[model samples]
Target: MLESVLKTIYVIWYRELIRFFREKSQWAGMIMQPTLYLTFVGTGIASAMTFRQAPGGTPVDYMTFIYPGIIGMSVLFTSMFSGISIIWDREFGFLKEILVAPVPRWAISVGKALGIGTIVSFQGTILLILSPFAGLSLTLWTALKVLPICALVGFAIGLLGISIAGRMESMQGFQLISNFLTMPMFFLSGAMFPLHSAPQWLQVLMVIDPLTYGVDALRNAIYAGIPEAQAILQHSIAYDLSIVGLFSIVTAATGVTAFNRQG
Candidate 1:
């Protein structure tokens, strides 16, 4: 039984991956916005801005502060809506075939999340490669540390997407709802700006956003060597990791439940 479950997951994961890579347009569309933001926004801000202190109390370059946030933004937007494919599959009648298979709904949900996570991780990794241009170091240690963190961020957001998309019937409805959710989630996450820069109401919202912790974790890991980053991060790496892990698990379980009930 365990073997069968694993097989089901593998199959679902493989199918999603094949669908993604087969479409060259997916890669193009995914890369375009991040490229524009990194090029235009990063450069534009760097030109006009003097250095400022992050909410963590450390003085950081505007580019450095926003780099990780942009990474978080890229991962957040891509991963959170990755499960729109679930709705697509349903519309095309492919999902019915999967639903009828002798596998647990949870396994299928997890598999789909993992596939989307992997794809979005690739997107984040591409941005990471470009980070040096934005003034970050590209060491082996940084790469090793960042890869896992990116994967976690991707998986957590992908699970969040699945939790919504699993039971959704209409592609139009999914897009409408996802657009509504994504902007607030990204903005509140401190992706474009620091949480401390926000008003009190927005700060409270940031505290509730799981992506806030994910962005915080990425920033902490990426900037570990910087003296100011060390000074500002009152919370340890463990705090950020725990929050993202907890969010992923909760969202994944919720997705499974929703999928099971969708029948």
Candidate 2:
């Protein structure tokens, strides 16, 4: 039974990969948005704003601080919309065909989420190669450590997309709802600023936003590589990972629950 379930997951995951690569436009948008955000927005802000000294008394620029957050933003947008594929599958009659198979509903949901998560994670990893331009120095060991974190964050956000997509039948409706949700989540997650000094009301919202922890985890991991920045960064690796892990589990269960109710 376990073997069959695993096989189902692999097949679903593989299908997602094949579809994503076949669509050249998807690659363009995914890579373009993050690059523009990091280059244009990041550069503009870094020039206009003077940041406080980092933990070890080293002066840090706004661009350097916000780089990880932007990476989080990239993952957030891509993974959160992974459910659009589900809507597409449903509309094309592929999903209905899969549903009649002997595989469990939870497995299908998990598989779709994992597949999208895997692809988005790889995309984020490729983006990481540009970190040096943001003043982040990545050693072989650090790169190895960051891989799993990126994948987990991807999976967590993919579950969110699946949960939302499961209830949505129309692509247009999904796009509208996803855009509304994505903007606020990105802004509240502190992707463009530090949450430590945010307004109380904003801080409260950030605490409740699951993506906040994911961004914080990315920030924590990036800062871990910088000795000078270590003191100023507030979140510990363990704390950030714990929050993100819990969020993943909750979203995974939510996706499963929602998919189970599907006809």
Candidate 3:
């Protein structure tokens, strides 16, 4: 079982790496988006805002507070866009080749999801690398630990994306599904602000948003010890991870099931 899992992981991971490196512009975008958002969006928002007191009397300057949001948004979109690639694979017959592999169908589904997760985690590394510049008080140890959690969350999102992509019979149809999933999840996820401060409608919308759980989990990780966001995340970590875990299991089950279905 262990060897099978390892082999499955390696095959998908290698294919993902090849795909990522094959396009220079894609890699550049992955590294660029977070940097620009931190330098501009995060800082610009912090500069004009006067934060009220919260847990631990944490002072949220725009950049520091927005850093985690940027990371969260980056991971969310990166993993979700991975579905577009899966669509591309289908168009090019690559997905059929994968489907015909000798491995169990679940292995293939997990492999692809894990591959997407790896890429999304790479994006997180790029974002967090700019942490100090955005006045984020991050440590190497914390950042290292953040990697696995980010990857896991990304994996879960990838599985969800895979299931959605599987039902899309055409590239045009897949585009609509991608837009539908990505935009709503991003906007309603409290990525721009916390749920308590949001309007009642947005708060209710967040009740069904997986991205909210992911953002909360990530915030808890980096801010676990920091004075500002730490209190907010520390209070919320348990609940966030629980939700994230649930998302992972549910999406993975659905994705693997879809992979096993007859075409």
Candidate 4:
């Protein structure tokens, strides 16, 4: 059972990877916003905001302190709604081919999730590659350690996107989904601001927003100078992995069930 699942996942993952690179616009689109956001919007804004201590007591410049949140931002935005391609597939009939595949239903959804997740993670990796010049740094062990967490979140986002795309009947509906769910989720997350600094209700809202957990956990990982003995590292590691993993399973299962039900 496990082996079949693994093989199915592998096939889907490889196919997704190939399709991801073959499209020029997709690659360009994935990296474009992160590059511009980090280089222009983020830096441009940070030039005005004063540096302050993070949730931890560590003192640092604003850009450095906030860069991981931006990385999480890039990943969350790029990865989650990536199922927009399903919209095109719906129009042109490619989605039918996928839907009619002989493979198990979950395998199909899992494949799509992994494909989009991996593709989006690459964009985050590119940001990581350029991070040092942008004033971020971390140990080899720490960097490698944080990746699975990020990938899990990416996978969940992609799966949820697919589930939404599979369920919706129109682009207008998807646009409403984007506006109602995606944008609000991003705003509520600490991607651009600290949750503690917000009013009590906003803080309460942030708890339900998975992106907030994602950003806080990633911020703990990618940005350096963590105290060696601190539980923040442990808590961050635990929450990020747990939340992403939960999201992936739930969304993947939901997407698979919803699509296969239509069959």
TM-score of each: 0.93, 0.94, 0.89, 0.87
How large is the C-alpha RMSD of every model relative to the true structure?
Answer: 1.8, 1.7, 2.3, 2.8
lDDT of 2 by residue, 147-235 (tens): 67777888888888888888997999888988998899999987888776688999899888888887777777777767666664657
Worst 10 residues of 2 by lDDT: 49-58
Query: Clashes per prediction?
Result: 0, 0, 1, 0
Tens digit of per-residue lDDT, candidate 4, span 93-179? 977786676566677778778887777667767777777756656677656745765677788887888788878778878768866
Query: How much does candidate 3 score in TM-score?
Result: 0.89
| CA lDDT for candidate 4 | 0.71
- lDDT per residue for candidate 1 within 158-188, as digits (tens), equals 8878888886888888788888988898888
Better of 2 and 4 by TM-score: 2
lDDT of 2 at 121: 71
On the 0 to 100 scale, the lDDT of residue 230 in model 4 is 36
Off by over 4 Å in 4: 1-8, 53-58, 224-234
Tens digits of per-residue lDDT, candidate 3, 15-69, equal: 8879887989999988888788777777676677775534466666656666777
lDDT of 2: 0.82
The most accurate candidate by TM-score is 2
Residue 101, model 3, lDDT = 70
lDDT of each: 0.81, 0.82, 0.78, 0.71
* Best candidate according to lDDT: 2
